[model samples]
Target: MLDGQASDLRVFALGTDRAGGMATAAQILGGAGTGPGEFQRPTALSVGRDGLVGVFESTGRVHLFGRSREGELEHRTTFQFRMDIEDGCILGHHLVVTGLHSEHSGVVHLFSTAGEWVRSFGRFYDTDNPWVSETIERSLVTCLEGSDEILVAPLFLPEARKYDVLGNLLWWTEFDGLRPIYLAETADGMVGVGTPEDGYHGTIGVTGDVDGGIAILQVGFITRERRESGSDPEISTYVLAADTGEGALLGRDFGRIRDIDGKGAVLSRGVPFPTLRVITWPPSVRQP
Candidate 1:
């Protein structure tokens, strides 16, 4: 699962092994199409509070669909662009898309739910500051629940950043070895998982029947930041370790986690054979 949303009657799954197909609680919607409601290389999916589903295809298009009375996908509209979209999320009546250009610069574009382009800001590069250059190429965008802020994770930088709705950078922290690929926020704090840049591997028991098994160094952590009056936020980081029985859970390629009810998380291990697992926190240490 890439991203999923649940309505009163059905659940929606995107980027499964089905290839450009959107799966419902009972059936699949569209798959690998250039025609209406079809997708080619669907990269991200998000559902709004009103049951509207937004699917982002790698070919620079977004298809919006609604659930039918019979619990099926009903094609609504398509948002088209020229740049390659890396990831997207639905924020209320707005859609947020992030991607890179031929010039090796990153961008974040906002659009209306109706597919109207809003405004874009990014490609933050300052030749005078090498630190600023490292923060330019953002690869993921997700909304902070119940807040007007959005979090973005860079492709190569070991930092996750927060920005206001208008694209002003409010706060950021450097997580030395983690190269985050996904982000989710909850009432307690924000949780993220990513590949460890440093050669750090944890010993988890083997699964299936592979000899010597594989050591997975994927990192998951919960971070809490406190912003005081007229001061920068104080950041606290806790690195999480995988349980023994977890067993190569994070070794899968292109893995992501999403929060659930502030207690557990839904982990989606991507590609080849995709799998979804629901994991609880504390002892599990994998809270979305």
Candidate 2:
């Protein structure tokens, strides 16, 4: 649960007893879980912007499932894979996914609103590229509401890359010790990133491009560990930018939380308190 709320990402199945396809009645499995895919097995799942259930099956298919306007949930389509996990994001009409094969064979897979697979970006995962080699870099993509470009966050490779809507690499940056935890595109024509800083709290980082350089916003840290890991403690809420990855702050860490029922509501304290926190960027210096 995030901030005592549950993420919509869910997993479901058709049968109740075993790991298999759906039975007649069908069961919706959920929580942070994974199973077998086509070949490599099911590793991850997400609710794409299009509300389609995107599943990363091992055989290289970003399985798409969604409920139509009629409120029926079913398989929408399947994005095939030559040799990679086809991770994807769906904007209003555009869907962008990554096809990662190995250390030297990956590319960006683009799809249209009609569920038709389109073209790909980059040099088709060449092995000779300096920033990329045979090492196929499966880029992490984030689509901002207003922009056409997809902010591509590579898999912590030596260099970072961003791609436009037409599948062109826009920028490739290299940071010394900065490992990215959050990535998104902002309305200001810049990419937002969050990184962790080890100190009193976790740090959140954000930077925007200006004069061909990055401008840092607020740097904050997550302090939940201070309270959750300690004795009885009070808590405070958090405030972040309308978008994330503006300045670096520690990501929020939470312990278990108990006593919340279905649907949901705000919770401050509870008996037999477990860790339940909705994490975000920018730690707070102000006390509650």
C-alpha RMSD (angstroms) for model 1: 15.0
| Model 1 weakest lDDT span, ten residues long | 203-212
lDDT of each: 0.52, 0.42
* Per-residue C-alpha lDDT of model 1 across residues 174-276, encoded as one tens digit per residue: 5454433333333454333443333222211111101212112233332222111222211222222211212213333234444233354455543344556
Top candidate by TM-score: 1
TM-score of each: 0.59, 0.46
Q: Over the stretch 98-170, how does candidate 2's per-residue lDDT look in tens digits? A: 6654333246666675656667666533344433332335444444433455545444342334556777666
All-Cα superposition RMSD per candidate: 15.0, 13.2
Q: Indicate the worst ten consecutive residues by lDDT in candidate 2.
A: 257-266
Error of 1 at 92 (Å): 0.8
The local lDDT score (0 to 100) that residue 277 gets in candidate 2 is: 29
